[model samples]
Target: MASKFQGFPGMDDILPGEIEKWQWVEERARAFFEAGGFKEIRTPILEPTELFVRSIGQSSDIVHKEMFSFKDRGERDMTMRPEMTASVARAVIERGLLTQAKSLRLYYVGPMFRAERPQAGRKRQFHQIGAEIINENEASDFDAIALVHGLLHYTGLKEFSLNLNDLGDEESRKKVKTALADYFEKEKNRLCKDCRWRLEKNVLRIFDCKIAECQPVIEKAPWEQFAPLGANFRKLTAKLADYGIPCKVNRRLVRGLDYYNGVVFEITASGLGAQNAVAGGGRYDNLYQDLGGAAVPCTGFSIGFERLLTAIQAQDEKAFEEIRTRRVYLAPLEDCAAVLNVVRETALRLREKGFRIEMSPGVFSLSQHLKKADKLGARYALIAGLDEVSRGKLVVKDLAKREQAEIEPEKITACFEQ
Candidate 1:
């Protein structure tokens, strides 16, 4: 095969049957975000290369190895965004959204790029539904946590848990890192290559290592040896516990991004195999200021759309039947011109009434057309032919009941409304 014809190795084509799950999840996310006071934001797929390096951290795997960076034809450095938070932070600051109000809550749903070995639930190009709340106080953090809890409950997952951790403010982190640095320096040779790299860049990230080889060494190693929380961080943790969020002192849970400074967390399921992290996020107090905006505090979380679907499907066999049955396929016979016109008009009216309709203009024979409707699992088939056109009426077939009825063309949209 030629290189031009081959898609990038880790990306996937979302075929017809696969997209319905995505649409269902997206609709649910929109409804949930709106109820939580988050407005939607759209960002460009391409970004300046420096955004990831400065915001995600140059030493992290995302920037150091996974980013799809290239020079445009004009020799300008550009990269496909590996995550949405940085771009969102830049937009919030550049637009001066914070100046208008004390806080900003925004959500985004889009594709993210990263070069990696594609595994189950892990793709080079994947989609994420993420939200960010900026310039908030203690109440905002609690709200963010509550929203995350509510979202998972709404998603209908029975076997998942949220892992929560509080990353202390910079002053306390400095004291902690100093202690851990001494410990890591002595056990430096025993640490994995990735952990060694993380030690110099962000020691907190070393706790997130998934390498089986590094597990034993990390298990015995004291997390407090590297970092400890300040008094303020402890108070925030206690407050979360008071709200019954079921948080624990998980020193091992840390975010991959460098911008996160407090309250890092993730959601996981048992059935997701080695890649158990299905969703995660944390607070980024310095992100706005680092991205050249005024100093502000923000926190949010993201759910991996594909991974969440995988877990749902694995747990429940019948979860997708409702989504797959939401269409009314329109099949027209003779009077190709007039029949097609009726089909188009009918579809528009039905769609306006909030019904999903599929059209088949090329199908000719009534038998073949009805079969098409059945194959698509259409709830109803709107049939129009020369006979119906002559009478100015439409034949509606209830594919589910195998019954037929005649209705005036103008009244077709009312059929599904019942």
Candidate 2:
């Protein structure tokens, strides 16, 4: 078997050194979500097939094309979640989280699998950070948008704009979608094959088509003209403006997911070719009740983590510093076993004190250890040998400045404070 330990096709690993940027973004997300009163929630990655089909709609692209479906040992059909909202809805209702609370605001961050093409950011198993606010006023929709805006701004994501549009309330959208059916009925040859199939199933997807030829046709289409804004929808948009967030009214902004019922919006950053939607979400006013739970209004958004990260890098190549695990390394002379043990113990103590420590695995020459420390990007190298160990002292050298100092071993912690 040719040493088959390769990663699954279309999936890749998050290598160790590349995690600093992810850590920074995740920390900011945790802080922002906490400040907004949205507690964290984790649901199982595997969900029943019916959960998605019932909520995301069978005709939608996610359900029809991208879902990773399989059968369990008991022969029950199951699917790895392609998106989080439906699973969150099912979990919320099944766990009865909504029964006791007047409102539930939850945020989730985890992997979602979809069998899509391997592109710059669209992976088969990619991660997403999302939030959901259920059982609240329509105002919560704007609040969700504001929260997303705050994260983007806080993370230094510039050169982006939020496209806001209401799918209209469920009833209003039905009226508009029904009214436009005949208008596009005879234009089958004019639209792309995907748009043609979607015309009857999800007319909104035609507007979101990425095909260059289909773009002009959808652009000229009259769908936006017919989608009217109701009072609730107008108030939501107004509230977003009052918060100092600039939003453009894009009538053609229909998300591919079926669960998005009321307001649908997406954030796009310029220069992210083909996969430009950095984040998106919408109001699923009836999704909770439709999934056999109490009627609750909910709205949320998700950051396409990989896509957004790529966009940031493309715009600013030097944004991320080189990855290094250690800020300091301790080197002990090759012949000094006892001194090596003391140095190792000191390194462990520094780590427990929240300092990043690095060292050679076994004893090595002083020159070799210093070379390794420099390569590993260690700023300070602490040296201890037979002489220092006997005296209970250490020789600290600054790699950048080529400066050295003799310090008592007990006072090593002071170096970090300085």
Candidate 3:
């Protein structure tokens, strides 16, 4: 039965069993980022609305249509972050991290808010695992791409495709925008109302349109003639090939955000239908300057944590078996005070030694404890009863093997170690 009162519509509670999967990925991501000279950064979820307005562009969908914005008690306009890049730039500049480091390699893991019509693998409040290389050269675009590639690969995704594109520098993008406006304008009658509005607003946004009616006019647009994947990108692809990183050029891969300039790319994994892109990003060299900072060359990418996990689960059935079955179920076989004390002490000690212990709040019968342990897929049950506690010993039962052994109080950790 559903609860009479439920959580707000796009928010979800990441309950216990499922939350372990999230933790595993988060741990792996932290290790990988730290190893690559990246440090973690956390910023508040709320920021001044103008931060996004200035950085993501006034014409972008995130600013105009999707942002969750409101005026605060003091009448200051604030917004729940719709994306991280703008917020990151705000943080790096505000905190003087800019002066502290010549080049900053930073990573973030957290939730982002966007008002979107929800669908499979897409959420209104979705989480992201992303990294940025600030003040690095153009080659850092490739570095950011390769980092995400290696990250997804590390998470055990065997089959995924990389689609690359070059949005060019500021000077080239204006030319592309003008050419796109002229071409999209000729076919204005064929465009959806949004595309027509976008044509005058930000012509590049037309490529982001998903309406079935606009495909014909958009497909024939002269993207290459106006903004061809330039020679510099040719060198990037060749370098990728030299290192055996597979990629294919996609002229239409211009990303949604407006601050993006220079190279842009998207990575797609199979099993996700139309929304197959699991991760995407590119260079946005001007974003810092847009948010009241010095000109900082930067490249970064963000992976949809939900979408990437779904892709991994679709291909592997036993995806989180190890995380599931490794916990020790602490069983107070008898509800006596002494037995409870022994079980509590043992649980704390095991947890201190880095073992996950599952201890129920209420006491259960011996048979009930065993059943609960099996139901949770617990590998072992640490049993303490009046008799065992009186003898200063405990019974460790291997739930899977149907085996039991007696160990002294001091030897319980060693028993589980075996």
Candidate 4:
């Protein structure tokens, strides 16, 4: 026997039976963003390897350890994007999108490649749905937060918590960096090997340490004293209350990215294990300047599409109960030589008239057709056989109601009428 093949270990296939859930989430997100004046942006999956190094920071985990990098035949270094924000910034600069408008509200939904160690939900290839508000000031921070809140609500997520933090401006962050470095330097011997390196390379990364040994040192750091929520951050949180979006100020919630400054946030849900954050983003005012462009203050957030789906399913699978609503499973129950043509035509007409149809590939008996239809969760089955063709009518079987009626082709809409 020949050897069988399967997907790469850390990559999961979005198989057919489960794809409807993804479609539902994507549809809701697009509708939510479009209504909020955001246009969708599609960027290449691969970029110059240096783009991530400069934008995400060489000391950050994504650039330092996670990126999938390679060189093309032309001897140019390239890498699959581990995240989209950097790629979006590159597009804005390259295409002069900013020149067309003062600011851009761009959203994206796509796969990102990372070499993360495979876990229950973490994968080498994962999806994210993110949006950015570029060339906007810190005031637009509230709008970004509200957009995320509104999106979660619109997507049928019932329970999730917003986590807020202020990394402060560049000047303030420099001060905090020094303070954190000084505090961690004293506890250097107690730090884990990774934290020890982070202390010297990028001190803020010490807070991201998951090793239990580093917790005490991290917790004792006087973060608030050095990097207090500035007056602008306070006003933004007040706006959160005015708009009734509840959030917790998590002082320890600094994200893993180095580009983040000013306001940063994460939204977490319960179903996911230790890595429960479903979405996170913050203001990266200097990322543009870091990547050969002017300093463009941009605030954006990306939702982990897999985690978001998992959370929604865990809370209420009912959100997708109606995914098959108005769907018709088309069956050809007559002779393959004679009835298949008419059945194919009918399927086409119904689809053209705006019906979600599933057509059988081969001729099957009525019972077999009905069984498949039921398994597919179709609301109705349109049966086409030699008898119905001769009679100039088609049999419409109500899969759920267990009723059948012979109706003319033009009257297809009547069968669905409640």
State the C-alpha lDDT per candidate: 0.80, 0.81, 0.87, 0.88
lDDT of predicted model 2: 0.81
lDDT of 4 by residue, 70-183 (tens): 999999999999999999999999999989999999999999999989997789999999999999999899999999999988888889999999999999899999988988
For candidate 1, which ten residues in a row score worst on lDDT? 224-233
| Cα lDDT of model 1 by residue, 308-356, tens digit | 8887777777776765456778877765677778878887887766566
Whole-model alpha-carbon lDDT for candidate 4? 0.88
lDDT per residue (tens digit) for residues 161-241 in model 3? 999989888999999989889898889999999989888889998888999999999899888899877787899899899
How far does residue 136 in candidate 1 sit from its true spot (Å)?
Answer: 1.5
Q: Pick the winner on lDDT between candidates 2 and 4.
A: 4
lDDT of 2 by residue, 189-294 (tens): 7888888888978777677678877776677667657776777778877887887888898878888887787788899996688778999998888887778887
Q: Which ranges in model 4 have alpha carbons more than 4 Å from their true place?
A: 1-3, 333-356, 385-395, 404-418
- Best candidate (score: lDDT): 4
Candidate 4 TM-score, C-alpha based: 0.91
**What TM-score, to 2 decimals, does candidate 2 have?**
0.86
